[model samples]
Target: MKRNNFHTHVFRCGHAVGDEERMVQAAIENGLVELGFSCHIPMPRYRRHLLKGTIEERSINNIPSFIRKLILGGPNMRMPYSQRHIHLKEVQRVKEKYKDEIQIFQGFEAEYFEDYQDYYQELLDSNTVEYLILGHHFDRSSINERYYGRAILEDKDVLKYASQVVQALETNLYSYVCHPDLFMIGKRTWSPACQEATTQICKKAKELSIPLELNSGGIRRGLREIEGVVNYPYPYDEFWKIASEIGNDVVLGIDAHFPNNFKEENYQNLELFAKRFSLHVIENFTFRKGKSNK
Candidate 1:
């Protein structure tokens, strides 16, 4: 299969390293045919959203960021809204500069926030990005207690992840689902409840003809024993097992936070995971059109 990655991120997102040009250059050096920048989508009036909730909404480790949000209201979880324009402009410049070497795309890895639904549509309608991928990191709101990765530990939240993922897919705004098993990062036990939740996401993606991404970001954490089975936090074995049974299309996402994340090791691990579960991993995706296309 031709090498490509559509889940790339950069320093503007506040949790990543490297810049757009550096990542694009890295992709070219790695012999990738295509590279898509999918940094976290910046929200309008992000500071207001931060202020709407109390500090209790933030996790203990994120206290320093909470303080940053309170005063500076600059990039933390996502790029500050003010930085969005500059990020887009820079990507355009790099895409043009690297056009002869590789295909570069602009995209955002977005969560399903009800308040920003219209804004998301606007982004698509205006051709602000080439595509969007559903990376449902948080629940309800971006800075909430119901984080899918860190806070979820029970069936209710995992089920919520499934329900909301289905809802995000129904909108037809996302090209693919990034880390459908992100809930597994928090709830590791492969219990009946976990199976049920995974089943929901797999079945719906199969129905929508949307591809589920086996994210390499989780693999960066390395293997650990979850219920005595050593594995990466996501591309979670049991989750992909259900997805395999459902015969859903799967894609490999580097989920690149740094330029080096595009290295062959991550892709190899993603392939190994796919082979382990007999996942039908596809190499390309369809970019869903926004409401404005109507």
Candidate 2:
């Protein structure tokens, strides 16, 4: 398969490491024909309150005061508006600079908040982003209410998360869904509820012709072994099995938080997972000029 990775991040997201240029170089070194920088977009400033007194606040407060201070002071969260503009400009420069060597794209891994739909539309109107991928890390439109992947554990929450993903896909605003099985992150056992929720998501994706990403970052994080059994939230076998049965389009996402994450081993693992599920993984995604790449 020709090497291509569309889901990538940079230091502006606060959690990811390395500069954008280094990420591009790493892609080239890995012999990738195409690389897309889909960094986390900065949330609107007015919505800062959504994160302030929520679960994130409690989590931050629990951290030792000094470590909390370090996290609060850093740009490791979402990029501020001004910083996002500067980052986009830099990405444009890099894309043009490496035009001949590789196909570089600028995009954002956007979270779907119903209340923030207008905010996303404004971003698109600005023409700062070339593509957007739906990365639903939270359950409710009000993310402060419930975080699906990390915090929510009940099987019922799985349906909520899957429904949110389906809604995001219905918007027709995203090129693809990233980590569609992320809702199963903390889920340990496969149950009837889980199966039903996953089926709903898979059917919707198949009907919409949306490609679900088999994220490799989950592998890099290592498998979560609960009660002597290993579980992967993304690239989750059970979910992919259903997706394959439904014949939904599948794509491999590096979800690269660092330059080194674009490794041959990760690619191999993704391929193996796809093969295990009998999935036909899409190798290269076409980049749409002024819309989400499909």
Candidate 3:
């Protein structure tokens, strides 16, 4: 239970309280030795609909230009300002501030959707990024273009999207696959066919030495229905059964969007579930600083 937490989020990616110092303080208070800050990389462009969703929100009202530029990508969509020197400065500041207390690493949760392989490779090759994690919330490559909200709308594109996930994992570039169980909530129900597909993916993950995430964040703050009902990300029994059958590696990600979101109470239920299945805890993983030990 006492170990490092490597998948913390930061404020730049729409988090309300993911400031560097605040994150470090939270880790220290939690007695974590190795804390990693993995902010979401700015998407090539925020989807247009997202602009309508939060443009009038009070907190981001002051920096409307910044947020708009983020969506528009302005003149630098390919190499935007989000990937500029500011990230380096912030990482350096955090490292210097918490030198001995915690080993802070610079990382980004990159979206490995379609047409992003080169850009992601550039980021990985830039040498500034210490880790690369996958956040495949909405399949960017799916031909159907259905977002998480419409996951239950079955289509052949679903298979293509799932295969794309396998292809991305084939690259062996991700530190961890973020939220693999994310959209299972909206599935019609646990089906043998779905379980078979998941088993196949897990088999590949195991072969490629990639760790599939057990994301607490998905369970904690799930997508809401038009009727205001909250949907859990995955059924615990289904996940355990599939994982046990596949025998793939697993890692715990708090997927914390807000500060103090990974506290004992927040993670307790999932932790208990993981313990019951004997899933691997990623905190004990020892990499070569940057390169994965696998």
Candidate 4:
């Protein structure tokens, strides 16, 4: 089977470690056939600053407060317009250097905010980014919107998240949905509401023929144990079970934030999880460049 990981990050994403060259070398050494860099796209400066303040204020008594702060306040976490050009240049150079060894792709893990729709379009129009993966970290691009980590898994929140996923798929901008079950990050239990939300997401993905990613980053972070049950929010077995039932196209994303994360064991774990859930894992999905933005 072909080995590929489309969801990856680099030092540009502030919170992640390593550089693009280091990540590429690691992928080749780890026996991967293809590796795509989907670093976080920069949000507006004002929005980022506001989010940083909010995270700092609420981080006072939070467990993993340092991580939360890093995620929220890390400088250059997202690639601004000027920075993206440099990032793309570096990726192109690396791709040329390793062209014979392994395939390298340039892309971004972007948020689907209607307000920032034009920004994504501009990126696509520039013809520098090869693809975009929708990873909804927030309901909206605005600072006022609730972050997924802080979001309550109420019926309304679930519906809102699912609806956003549907809208994102409709845009046809994303190559796949990264961490489709990410809303379950802070969620303790797999409620009926969670199942319903995932069902809706799976149905839409199946209909659109867009692959949904089973991210391995959650596993690396450790599982959330609730009521004596251990589970990862993104790879939440219940979610993938529903996805399998719906017959949605699935892919394994390492979501590699560090160089060493692209390992054989991680791949084996992802494949094992897919098998347990009865998901049809696609190993060699083609990524075409200069595809229409709309």
Candidate 5:
């Protein structure tokens, strides 16, 4: 079986630790055959569009997001657009420097933003990015109350998450779905809406053959009591059970925000997640190449 992790991040994405070459060195140390640098993508006009979101209506929810964005000069959430070229240049240099040691890929863990549709296509068309995975972190906008990970008391937001994800998968742009169970972050237990959301996503991904990721980032949060159940914030047991029954193709994503995240324990946990859910996890998928020519 090929050892590869299609999710990773570096200092450019304010929230994570380490740099490009440091991350590459970590992957090589961990024996990763392929390491994908999927830092949060920079939107061309971020603050402009972010202001266009419903942030004003939800002033309180916008504070923390802005804290990182403002204090970090907006590098807190994602790399600023101006830094894109420099970031890619350093990544290209590291990629060339260690080509023989390990395979490195430049990818982005992106959200589905209709405003940036043309930009996403341009990145792919120009070969600026090798592939993209739908992280499904927010609603139409990124930094507002619409963020799916913002609140997780019930299925209301998750249902919306399902709707947006379905639309994204239909575009045939993303290579895989990351953390398909992200919306279950704080839910106490399963519900009908959870079933509806999971089923909707699994059916579409199965039809499109886009593998669903069993991400380990959520595993770092450790287990918690969901009513009587104990499990990670995501890669939720109930969610994966539904996925297992549906027989959707599954893949493991390290969601490596830190360099040390490329270790053996994380991989073991991912496999343990599959075993716990009876998931037939696959190790590879067709890396997407821009929009479908058809």
Candidate 6:
């Protein structure tokens, strides 16, 4: 029972309290070998001016309205902290300090958009990033353009979305698809066509030997949508069924955006999914080479 966690986040993305060094200590104490930090990428277009304050001290409502404004403005807006000095120094410091104690790979939880294809291509081409995790923050180009945690994928958009996902997956650029089933939940119903499209995408992933993630955060958030007998969020049954049928490799992503989120209940539930699906658990799969020692 190796303890490895690949999908994780840091303070820069917003929720977690402690920074990378503290997280590494927790991971070591918890008997983890690999603990990746896939923070949200810097989208300069999305970065709006905000009143700076400590995330822990700031009121949720009073935190800032910039996120909403940026979302409303569309994807062209760059990511917050794209050029922010503080974040740059923080990431560098973490990497330098923890270089010997834990594995710390540079990564991003990428947003899926038609425009994202180009942006991600640039990212992949850079060769600086070790892993890419596709987290569908928005379903379509139109509508609210908001970053709702719930999946809002429609049947008609399924093919296109699936195609973009396939491209992202097959590119051999991404390490895993974070919260891969976000679209299956939400207001849009999954149709026969959508399922078929997904099946194709799964097949492609299987061929590429890319791992599809079974995210626990969605389940923890109590956002599971009921579709037939399979639960939403990760859609374990449907997802596992397809993966098993296609022999697709599966990864369990806790998506632990917060420190307190790494708990027993959710870990047990995720393990149950692995057992139910007979999926391999790649615990302690460190992306950073030297970090697991200390």
lDDT string for model 4 (1-294, tens) is 678888989887667898889999999999998889999886555446545645655533333543443455434446544456677888999999999999988888987777667777667777667788988877663232356655455667877888998988888888888889887876657788888889989998898788999889877777777788888766888899899999988889999989999889998888888989889888755443223633
| Model 3 local distance difference test score | 0.61
Q: Would you give me the overall lDDT of model 2?
A: 0.76
Could you tally the backbone clashes for each prediction?
0, 1, 0, 0, 0, 16
In the range 1-294, model 3's lDDT, one tens digit per residue, is: 664666776655543455778888787777777777777665454444334334433234235554555454431212234554675687789889888888887776765665666666666676667777876655552112334424573434345445756877776567777776544655645555566657766777777777777777766755444344434655245656677567767777777667677577756766776777777655544222222332
Candidate 6 lDDT score at position 135: 76
Residues 88-178, model 2: lDDT tens digits: 8888888999889889887888777776666666566567676788888765432333656665478878877778877877776777888
Residue 263, model 4: lDDT of 88
Each prediction's whole-model lDDT (CA): 0.85, 0.76, 0.61, 0.78, 0.83, 0.58
lDDT of 1 by residue, 1-294 (tens): 789999999998888999999999889988899999999888887767665545436453576777786565555778777788999999999989988999999999999888788888888888999899999987766664657887447888888888999999888888899999888878877778788888888888999899999999889888889557987888788888889999999989999888898888879988988998899989898898756442
Q: All candidates: CA RMSD in angstroms?
A: 1.9, 3.5, 6.6, 4.0, 1.8, 7.8
Candidate 1, poorest ten consecutive residues by summed lDDT? 52-61
Q: In model 3, which residue pairs have backbone atoms overlapping below 3 Å?
A: none
Q: Kindly report which residue pairs in candidate 5 clash with one another.
A: none
Cα error, candidate 6, residue 70 (Å): 3.5
For candidate 3, the per-residue lDDT at 166 reads 82
Tens-digit lDDT track for model 6 on 54-129?
2322433322344553454322222244433454455567667766766555666775554445566565565445
What TM-score does structure 1 among the candidates reach?
0.94
Positional deviation of residue 147's Cα in model 2 after best superposition, in angstroms: 2.4
Instruction: Estimate the TM-score of every prediction.
Output: 0.94, 0.87, 0.77, 0.86, 0.94, 0.74
**Once superposed on the true structure, which residue ranges of model 3 sit more than 4 Å away at CA?**
43-80, 141-146, 149-158, 222-231, 285-294
Which is the winner by lDDT between candidate 3 and candidate 6?
3
- When 2 and 5 are scored with lDDT, the better candidate is 5
Q: Candidate 3 at 260: error in angstroms?
A: 1.3
